[model samples]
Target: MTPETSETTQAPEGHAPSHRADGRRFRWNKVPEITVYFWVIKVLCTTVGETAADLLNEKLGMGLTGVSLLMSALLVAVLVAQFRTRAYRPGVYWLAVALISVVGTLISDNLTDNLGVPLETSTIVFAIGLAVVFAAWYRTERTLSIHHVDTRRRETFYWLAVLFTFALGTAAGDLVAERLDLGYWISAGLFALAIAAVAVAHFALGLNAVWTFWIAYILTRPLGASMGDYLSQPTADGGLGLGTVVTSVLFLAVILGLVIFLAVTRRDVIEQDRITPQVAR
Candidate 1:
């Protein structure tokens, strides 16, 4: 990721500075604040993404291609609703996240299972893709801060980056867990440790917030995916044997309850800058 410019100093973790270096506050951001709730929900979405994709592929009998197309279509529809709204709507935003998670997993799966791409190759490919998106986004917008995701263009860049993160995470996680024979539990532990280190670097070592945030975001996908596999796979396969159906439903239910709570409480809402009408124009 590009270095955050001096003009874009770090705000508190999970909060963005309201005023830019130019003294202009952006319009209301469309994403929720990076609160604990946000991280919990994001991990849950990724877990559901991993297992739910498996469930659909098994039950739908439509093959990976069919499931990918179906999930991708649903993702597009939810994103359309997300874009139509003027501000953050927890339901719409998270629904899009969950759908994108599934779609992202499917993309990685298709490349590996169908096209015979090696996990290492896919991992590198997706990492490059994510970097390109970030570079393009930073070049065009001059900042890659999530707090500034108020405009439609920024939101577009944000989602594209998110999709790549999930895809990259899936590929990398599989490379470590399956290819390297690390096992699901071990893989999950490793990713969790990695995320913890990123946090320490940001809080204790004074790393750039923008870089740490994106790094943690990308790592959560594999962590969550590994967790999902550990819980849902067969006992003989080193899992708890809950099965994908149970695992997916459990995570989805939790996600639904949280989304409803956030919608009602509005705790995660990022308030718009108190700009007057003339200034807003």
Candidate 2:
């Protein structure tokens, strides 16, 4: 067999036997399984969330509070639907992520803009909150692996961590951009470099998966938000002046196309059988 055919033939042997029978696996759902495609679409969704929130608040004149409230309600509804489902559905999962991303950005914005909270304070607060969440999750379950998120408690922790990451990222990004005087493009570049570093540490340096995952997850928020700001803000604000509406629409289209492709191909299905703890007997 050709090398390609040999690799293809080996793929089936890697899956757990249980997956072959029932197709229900103990893997991440409500989100795309981690792949390059997953990260690309995640960044796109975050960009949409950032720009869409801005459009709703600025162009539509909804104001920050109004847009925040609207998106918060939508996020809660989608999350409820997500929790209700037993299996991962791409449509439901991505919608939840997108909505939560918007709400998360709004939470940070509200603190900084409306409540007069310092970005530093917000960043520290979110970091503490995220640490508490991980502590509680690990203490209760004795594991933080995403592959084992088959129970309600684990899933709740998963979403909570996600929310905190966005909030934390928003604060950190703004801190670097506004307080530290890094321009939008520079901020984006810094965050991109940080994410690359995390990937290197994870794959090359024997870093813990959980730590690597959360670090990269938090970084993506700022990376995406900075890119969104670069594309949508006025020239005076250092952006290209595409406007939030156009930026949001463009990213949303890409997200929709990708989600549809994943749904149809099932390329991200988690293989539950591989998750079984090996016995040393």
Candidate 3:
């Protein structure tokens, strides 16, 4: 999610509503509030996704097909629970994100590794897939903002877009570092620079908040993937040689700590006030 303190309340018709114990009612967002913690945890989860996918595929001998099936099954179960709940649950929400990230990586891996698809081709395919998802989402919902993900259809579109983003990120990241010979660290640096530029354009140059947020969101996937590869790959492959096990464990630990903090503090929970005029005042 994009980093911000609040969300826009107005939404088109068709959102499901929730009622409190006292019979008071409101429309709630399924996503967490956009904050610094949101971005930090997002990047960490992406890193974990990259490394954990590698660990399971290479170490556990799951192969790309096995891991993809496993992760996709897990993602479906988690998303089922997520959809049933009317509001965001930190554990459930982040779990879905992490699993989706892994599944997304596996999807791209299957195309490139198992099917012998070129990284360049996979990159373009995922990019176009993402664009199509975005187009359909906007056409159906009339808005692409995460803040407006209050309806089931909107939420479905959001997750689809996210999945494509991760797939695109994996393909594009590998294309630059592994396929193009730029190396992991340099690729990471390149993505980092791109994200920084988006941030600058958003804060320093008045870029549209929604556009900037999505741009940064797309960039962070490749950034995190490159970082994960740089840290987890063998030293002979130009990495620090921490290995996937160590890297996955380390990032998972951090993600757990942060999720706990957010859950206890409810800091990242987006209350319904901002999106509902009745509660806004």
Candidate 4:
């Protein structure tokens, strides 16, 4: 996907940065600080989101619509707590993320399985939807950077972009692996290479961090989906046969451990930047 090029600007004046739980000064971004741990945990969350969604759908015997409704309701509850918070609380933010991942997957699954929408169509539609959201967000606030998401409108845009990315990723991943018949391992490797290329372009070739980040963020969902499918699907299906339960449990445990570490250390809290306001205006 091509990254949209737009001039950066901040939200309107009168919005102030927030304080941390420890009373330290910080930005009021509703999301966590971006770091290695952030990306690792994000990927893990995506994997578990895929596997756990599958497990629940199968074990609970809830057809696509039922599972979609249940997860959507749960996501709303989690997002309520997330919206109520003033700062980035790892638990609430990440819980919302994990739930959103599942809900997003279910959304794509419903369109494809229940509604008989084609994967290619779903991928294109979600991509266009995400573009629209980003455009509207930029038109309103003048910046798509998460670092400047201090207002409720920016937070809303952030979550909407995230939801679309998850849905798009789910569709794109299946389009390549299942519809295109590339198999799971090949698909994982392909996405891994793509992510690595994005990193190199950002670090070595001077790509914009915001664009690079959002691009990489979209890719992680598919990467994790492929990895989850590769690990959990049966050997006859070109996977390792680990089963969904085991894969979900393993990834969730890893995510939990990392989140706990982040919570205790508070190392991922983003600092308030003096020049951010100037850019926003």
Judge candidate 1 against the unseen true structure and give its global Cα lDDT, from 0 to 1.
Answer: 0.87
Clashes per candidate, residues 3 or more apart or on different chains: 0, 0, 1, 2
Question: How does model 2 fare in lDDT?
Answer: 0.81
lDDT of 4 by residue, 155-234 (tens): 89999999999999899888887767888878888998999999999999999998999999999999999899889999
Residue 105 of model 3 has an lDDT of 87
TM-scores, in order shown?
0.88, 0.87, 0.87, 0.88
Off by over 4 Å in 2: 1-31, 277-281
In model 3, the clashing pairs are: 9-275
The CA lDDT of each predicted structure is: 0.87, 0.81, 0.82, 0.83
Better of 1 and 2 by lDDT: 1
- Evaluated at residue 249, the lDDT of candidate 2 is 92
Off by over 4 Å in 1: 1-26, 274-281
* Model 3 agreement with the true structure over 130-212: per-residue lDDT tens digits: 89998898776567877767667778988998898888888887777775688887888899999999999999999998788
TM-score, cand. 2: 0.87
Model 2 Cα displacement at 238 (Å)?
2.1
Candidates in descending lDDT order: 1, 4, 3, 2
lDDT of residue 177 for candidate 1: 81
Alpha carbon lDDT of residue 67, candidate 4?
A: 88
Steric clash pairs (candidate 4):
9-280, 10-280
